[model samples]
Target: MNTSLPPVEAAPTGPDAPPPGAAPTAPAKVPMAELFITFLIIGATSFGGGVVAYLRNALVLQKGWLDEERFLSALEISQALPGLNATNMAIIVGDRLRGVVGSVVAFLGITLPGATLVMVLGVLYASNAKNPYVNAALIGVGAAAVGMLTAVTFQIGRKQFGKWIDVAIILVTVTLINYLHVSLIWVLLTVGPVAVFIYRPSQLEPPSVPPKQETVP
Candidate 1:
């Protein structure tokens, strides 16, 4: 994983550091130009498997652009969608930042630079894939991608498995998917709402108790 992160614990300030509210505040409206540039940077540099983890750390933790609850909501929706995780993430994050415009900016930002780079690499590989050195390099890159993905799994798992019920749901879901080889749509349709009902942080809280009165002699 990339080690470059700004200090998360630093005192908050600026437009990005608004006070907490019942609903999380939207990010300051940045120009489409700026949004595109920021995501372009993320797309260009975020290598291997941990891209989503890197994105969460970068946007939510280090940048303080999103609170934890909101971030998790977006992540859940993104994972449920049938598409490339990173691309889905871009849409979610962008939509949060600036609604439809932000989503378009983020999508373009994530796709353009990386697509160009990959295209170039693909052309080169098409010519040189048979070469020992090129093949070895591709294999190394593939391994790095897997390593990054594993890191993302660990990070997301930590966030998702907040309660014992969450663990149970995860175990059950994994078993159904891996052992039974059940279709994902069915697994999600079954588990998604159940997990939402069972592990909802709101439902798990203790009810407020009234203060006790003093006893008369």
Candidate 2:
């Protein structure tokens, strides 16, 4: 007589399944406390106007929280809107990782140190405004800030500057704003459309060729 036990079925797997004998993967949720602490450290330690660079180092290089492309995308969105890029980035990234509470914590963490320092510095500057040393130091700082800004601008725009079309746009925008004294709203309304038209899909497509004429019978 046949007395063999029935065979058991193995578990099924899909794209997200781990390889056999591999450890199970965990979800990508970041702890709220860790998020706040990380941003707080970035805010406290970042010097000059290089908070963005510091943020990249911490989030991308050190923590592996955001990759380069995601960071730049976040930065573009932040700059396109009307707020500080660093704080905007904090809010965006935080919200992405953990929603509303994350946004609040990240914003507070990144801004609190700077805000507190600014208040202290403002009080000190008010009392010392009359001192010649303070005046000279402030002037030096302003000049250095201008130089740093120029350098950073060129560095960030180096790839775009390599293209003649981009350079032309830059020159035209500068001339319109600086020399022509055109309102930014008008300049954007005028130049924006023209730029879009210049690079439109139809403009880039080659002229279609007609089929050759039929041969004589």
Candidate 3:
């Protein structure tokens, strides 16, 4: 008899449930202490740039506080903002779940651990800048970060890959950043609006021609 529970799925819904991407009408709130502990754990354990991966696992897969669609929505909002993605996500999801107080609690929880670790690591690196073991560890961490980011990118964009327009957008964005060396500001200012227009409602919907006149029976 195994004592462990099964892993939770990303979205748990039955036939009658709302469509997959719909945001839940009301999010179930957790205790403030619990919320803080959750983000704190994520902040401490998530290495490199993979905080978003940890966030998705904790918030959607484990906590069930947010559905997969809602998690993605929050992630997009965080990316558009001016701060670190992990902190921005903390604020957005915290507000949704626990209001102003929750946001404060979450922000502190997520930042405090990283802040402390950075200070300590900075001191250690200053003293042992050329230590082979330390250098090797950093390189390993970088590799893991790249792998995490790649997996998450593919998971998030799997649907878009099939759409030529979306694929074009991805390619263009990468080309601009990698080959053309376009400033990120310019890329966002130009590509963002074009992408929006391409997917706008009017472009997606067929023109509303008047219904063909029906012959009276």
TM value for model 1 = 0.58
| Model 3 stretches with alpha carbons more than 4 Å out | 1-31, 47-76, 79-85, 205-217
Candidate 2: clashing residue pairs, number: 0
Ranking by lDDT: 3, 2, 1
Task: Give the CA lDDT, 0 to 100, for residue 38 in model 1.
Answer: 77
TM-score of 3: 0.64
Over 48-151, each residue of candidate 1 has an lDDT whose tens digit, in order, gives: 55577777877777656678887788888877778877888889888878789789889999888889988999999899989999989889989988887778
lDDT of 2 by residue, 1-217 (tens): 5654222111133345444334223324556777888999998998766888988998877766777888899989998787888899999989877799889999999998989999999999999999999999999999999999898889878997998998999899999999999999999899999998998988686658786788997
Stronger candidate by lDDT (1 vs 2)? 2
Off by over 4 Å in 2: 1-28, 67-69, 201-217
Highest-lDDT candidate: 3
Q: What lDDT score is found at residue 141 in candidate 3?
A: 88
Model 3 over residues 1-217: C-alpha lDDT tens digits? 6644332221254344554335556543466887889999998898757789899999998888898898999999998778989999999999988899889989998999989989999999999999999999999989988888899788879999989999999999999999999999999999999999998997787778998888997
Model 1 CA deviation exceeding 4 Å by range: 1-29, 48-89, 92-99, 159-163, 200-203, 206-217
Flag clash pairs in model 1: 49-148, 49-149, 50-148
Report the number of the highest-TM-score candidate: 2
Considering TM-score, which of the candidate structures 2 and 3 is the better prediction for this target? 2
Q: What lDDT is obtained when candidate 1 is compared to the true structure?
A: 0.77
lDDT of 3: 0.85
Write down the lDDT of every candidate, Cα atoms only: 0.77, 0.83, 0.85
